[model samples]
Target: MAARVRRTTRHSSRFAAGSILIAAATFLPGAESAADAPGLEVPVDYTCRFPSGSHAMTAVITGSIPADGTAGRPVEPRDIALALELPAPAVAELAGLGAGSVSARADLTVVHTLGDETATANWSGLSASAQGITGQEQVTLHAEGSVPTATFGSAGTATLSASDLTLFLSPLQEDGSPTEPAAIEVECGLTDGSDGTLATVVVAEAEGEGEGEGAEAEPEKPVENGGTAEPEEAAPGAPRIEGRLPAGAREKLEAARQDVEALADGPDPCPFPPIPLPTPADTYVAGYTNVEKMDGAALLGPAHLNVTLMKEYIPDPCTSTFKVLSEAEFEYGGRRQLPPAQGTFLTYGFMPTTATMELIQVGGPAQIESVSVTSDPAMPEYTTVTAEFDLRIRDVEVNGVPLDVGAGCHTVKPIKQTLHAFGTGNPPSGYTVNRGGSMDGETYIPAFTGCGADEDVSSLLTSSISGGGNYIKITQAPLCVLNDTASVDCPAKKPTPER
Candidate 1:
């Protein structure tokens, strides 16, 4: 959330966790949300509290959404738009930090100086960034995708979850010198679930050698002040700049990754039925692509190969609308004639399903609000989309053991899915700023009675991906596989970040 600021006095001194300057702030609902507002309109108002009183904070969002995903059209490139300004005095003081830049290094080591004494800390392995702070009225900061001024456009609330968010500031350093990096970097986390939004404000010296001394910097948890100074109160739902994610985030993700993989390449073969892509009526993100590939399954002892692909159109912001281009590129080959069971598809190729996702960031963390199976009678492609699992199953004997998989062999229960399970963006893709999710429908085997839970077929799917700014980075990625098109490779594990 907020950086643990250590408030120091006008006279510089060795800095501790809680020995930095303090500022108080608050927010008041200035106006009601324009529920009837036809098109997307963003309104931001916040003030940073100082020692005396509150200052006015305001920002403006200007951009257009296109209509690329309207019908069955192609995607186009888009960019985020935002403008913000800090108080004039803060701007002036920051400007006074003579000749230095604001910087956040990959592995940063700094020697804090307050008059004479100093301490060192190593902020390494992790990355952070911030931008848009030059003594000016407003600065341009692009936030790849679009955000909702009102929740689902009806709740009459705001998510403020712009694909990329920037905080303007005139950061200062000791001795009135600018920090080395010179810019504020911005990074957001979809893995944070509802409140995944975080920022690391880098406003200190990049490298400092104690006066007339030479020594290495070591990591240490600077002690806090004896609860003397207090931070300013934040607006009702202001996004916090948490330096790092919560503990066990990696562990939870690893567990999800292992489980999904088993389900994908398990006995059930296909856990995620082919779901319909979103249409123009849906909320659209700038650049989106999802690929899930699996192999090895013996349904009736016939070897099969399956791959599912999902993609969203990219277009200029103004006219663009949310829409998905989906395909079930599953291939079931081999002439080994296997006995067919009831309710099982003879090459059932994608039994049919559809998905709807919402990206949100308000009242909580920035995250994928909801991902549910939906149906559209007007479009028969996704008639089977539902939160309840209905993955088509079959009745047969595996290894000479008879198993029950529903009458028609269709799965119907709670479909299991995991978001941010593999970290950053979707697993396999692991695209930074891009959110990822997967579904592994549970398999049911008759427990000598009726259909009982067996195991799940892991699914490699990305229900949603947001924020790439103007530049789009497609890893050794794949496109939707259609008829006559060959399927692309989807790694069983998350890919390393593209250097």
Candidate 2:
């Protein structure tokens, strides 16, 4: 039997009670407060998906924490209610096990930033109510539980998907060794304890069941632990768990893990350092960022724009006018709100796109006001994100040609154009926005390079920026995933995926 949970410091290295038995010990990540700013309140909208042939569940994410910019607080789930649906075959198999009906009870990890590392808390309020036997059995599951109120060590976010949710039963260690602490045993009698009957699942030991065909049929394992149910052995490699799993249940488990839906937007988030311009609000939202430096020491291609400073006359500069803080990645496919600007400035040749940005870099305060992300009708599996941005670049250095605003030849007027960019995201993150074609059309200061009298760079801006067909592709420098909030070697996704 698992020991009763002993609540410890919120920043402790281990989980409570039954979780302790599993040894899910993790380190806490910390969040730095940005000017006692009001905590961020990000709305949650997520969906939990199972691999092919399984089902999906949707939930909302809500959180709060004080920071200067976007991300800076622990995100708590207002609730986590889901219905686990099984495939028809699994249902049929359940009937064979003499079980007229079955239900699933699993846990989802509430992920958040703690101290200086990623921390996870196991949430297990999953409840299931019998939905009347419809067809035959494998294991048609349903959940009717809610998440408990909790907080992370620091202010941040968390997300739930099949990969990040659902409890895994270990029958053995990765090296095929017996799992530590051993598996728990329970007896599922033929009748409920009441009525003078006790029906509880029991763990049965047997000779190893080889992996190939002609192998003994896997048992019919029902989802373990529902509302009020105690922890049961579920991890696959542990020691063959005796449950409601059907013969060949191993394949079934692997299959379910494959087809997961991107999570819905909640409080969960990730990366990128903000432009260094001083700002008011000190809040920073979590998400991913990918920055690529130009070969000729400029910002070009990858994100769909080529910026090479007129080196002979000026210096190389790079900048992006797309701000998508509150936007959803692979999860919710559609429009989203931009992160509020804590501090924005219109800098020139003076700042680097990232802390490590060395080549040509330049840009001013810009916003993505609003964006629309959808899937391609043809591929359906791919995500398509489009932005309507307004640019207000004041004196951007090109090839070192000083953006002399009122100068005769280089009468560079601030750029204020509405350019459109669309790109296909690689599976997970859902973004590969670029320059001119259907994919890489960046904004170019065409028609007039120097001065122009019309511009509106307000809350956000969008414009196709490029080096006037000078998509000078060259050997570039390695990308960097710099992060100041976490300890050295901490994970990063901003500007790019931090290794």
Top candidate by TM-score:
1
Native-to-model Cα distance after best TM-score fit, residue 245 in candidate 1, in Å: 12
Report lDDT per candidate.
Answer: 0.25, 0.25
List candidate 2 segments past 4 Å from native.
1-75, 114-116, 134-140, 150-499
Residues 201-305, model 2: lDDT tens digits? 111112353322122222323332221212233233221211111222233223322322222233333323433322111111121111111212232212212
TM-score of each: 0.23, 0.22
lDDT of 1 by residue, 158-218 (tens): 1122222223222335333335433333222122233311111112221332222322222
- Per-model clash counts, in order, read 56, 128
